[model samples]
Target: MRILRFRAFTRPGDPTSGNPAGVVLDAESLSDADMLGIAADLGFSETAFLSAIEPDAARVRYFTPRAEIAFCGHATIASGVALAREGAGSTVAFTTNAGVVPVAVSPERATLTAVETSVEPLGGVLLAELLDALRLETTDLDPMLPPAFIRGGNPHPLVPVAAGVLGRLDHDADAVLRLQDRKGWDGTIPVVHRISADRFASRNPFPRGGIREDPATGSAAAGLGAYLRQHGLVTMPAEVTVEQGAETGRPSSILVSIPPEGRIRVTGSAETL
Candidate 1:
């Protein structure tokens, strides 16, 4: 398998490394073990493998170093760009572990419409557990947004922070991993730092999937959009763009749209290696 690596939100990583994305177009030949091993070696937040099932659709899978995620935004963006580069520019459906998500591509960017998932308000035990794991108190959280566990294709905890704290992303990777492994949390303990009345910058601690932080997470953005709309934090006919991974130096952007009916639209731009 030929794996192409591209620097997302930045070109060239230092010795510390940027978010390295692996683009595998002809991924049908790779076994699950093969994909997992490749992802482990690459050590990116997520590696996307697109297996062509027909002329228009592909079975897309995302692998982290430790496990296979149901969905991934950065990988999807990278894969969509790869497909466009291969001259498959039409709308394509990706059958993910979460569900079938449709991706639309243009030369400029790609937008993904996530298959909807219901929202279960999280303010009791699950919410407390997540807060304790992240070493944060409820006082530090935005009371207006409250605490919510939103599902866009997967699950995520939405904790809104005060404005301008998004760049302060610091965590013990092992501690995060310990919590995820022990507690079986799917989405990261998402830190909604730098959140205004509407726009926000967020970070995801996805140790559950063997990833420490995700630069630009489309899935989480989708979930966040849903959470915002469901709780009336951000009103309808509004779109908020999220900035992530600036601290780790692989800055990424996620544009999320909230419709009047509370559906989400997530968009991002990608490049080829």
Candidate 2:
């Protein structure tokens, strides 16, 4: 049982700053409980297990320290890069619980295609609760972009805040977890500020998955792409960049591309650690 650790979404020339994920290439022999135990032992936000289903295609499962999630973008990127390093070809199709995520690999980076994404309205009551949980007031939120429940590979309630407020995202872990569960969100994505029409800064608090925060969240990035496109926040055929992990001092970036009509593409670099 060889477990490989890789740092996903690392900044160029800075391997130490990225999101870490565990990859188990030969996971066919491992059961669900075994995967859960391994993820808990590693203590990463998510770990990916791969089982060969066909040539250039594999069945991948994602598990957090506490439970299994439907999808994980960073882990998928890490696994695809791992497979490419092992001669799996330039492209791999991952049959995930959410959907089939196709990843295109290159020597320098990997790009993952997300599932269908949607942006739905956030209820008034839930929005208030979420604001309270994060210790934010309505005035602190971005005036142009109201909060909404964005669903890509997973569920994220994205709240856009004013400038200078995203750096102070501190709250009770238990209370935040409770709020996520109650609102049926996998995590809360508080976008600190929009640097430009094509770039933004964000922080994702994922207490429900037994993690305090994610340095880089690919799924959330994809979700945000969908939100921005749907709301006309950015121009069509948009390519957006999300800056994350700076608050944790592990700065990382995720590139998201939203086409005319299809799954969004999230790209990033990974390094073996």
Candidate 3:
């Protein structure tokens, strides 16, 4: 089994943007447990294992250190790029825990159209608990955008905060675990700015998955697009870009599209290392 690690959303070695993803080849031979172990060994926020069901279609699954997630955007971009190198075309689709995600690969970039996404109302008790785990105050949120539960393939509590705080995300790992299990949530991020009136700035804390921070998160960004739409944060219909990882030195970005109807589209580019 071969594993490929790459930078996504933003350039590698550039602080303050992008996602670092692990790509696995010949994953058809590996079992689910084997895949999970591989993710643990790689130590990336997400690792993708490809099991081909068709030449143009494959069953793709994502694994974090802690468990299998429904989908992962960065890994999808990395995989699409790898496949294209092997003669895979620009248009492609991957079956994931989230659903069938369509991907478009360009000469120097790959964009993944996320499965259906939506925003759920936040449960006050659970939100408070997560905030407590991170030692955040309600005032930290951007008064402009209220918090909501954003669901792409995974669920994330969208905490709209100030851009300055995006670089100051800190939290208790144990408490995050407790909150994740207690609230049945997968991950959480405190957001501040929308890159454009449509885009956003965010920092994700994924202690539940054993990740202190996620440099670039496409799935979460996709979810955010839906959450923003639901809350009327962006009354105008538009595609948005998300910038992350700057505070930690691995700058990343995610481009998302939201239509009045249908699933949100998340796009990003990845490079092999």
Top candidate, metric lDDT = 2
| Whole-structure CA lDDT of model 2 | 0.86
lDDT of 3 by residue, 109-187 (tens): 7878888887776648877886788777787766667777787778888777755665666777788778777777765
Who is ahead in TM-score, 1 or 3?
3
User: Per-prediction RMSD in angstroms?
Assistant: 3.1, 1.3, 2.2
lDDT of 2 at 211: 81
Clashes of each: 1, 0, 12
lDDT of candidates 1 onward, in order: 0.72, 0.86, 0.76
Question: Ten consecutive residues with minimal summed lDDT in candidate 3?
Answer: 10-19
Candidate 1: where are CA atoms >4 Å away? 7-19, 164-169
- In Å, residue 88's CA in model 3 sits off its true spot by 0.6
Q: Kindly report the root-mean-square deviation of model 3 from the true structure over all alpha carbons.
A: 2.2
Candidate 1 lDDT over 83-131, as tens digits, reads 7666774787889998888888664467888878566677887667766
Q: Please provide TM-scores, in order, for all candidate models, with all chains considered together.
A: 0.88, 0.96, 0.91
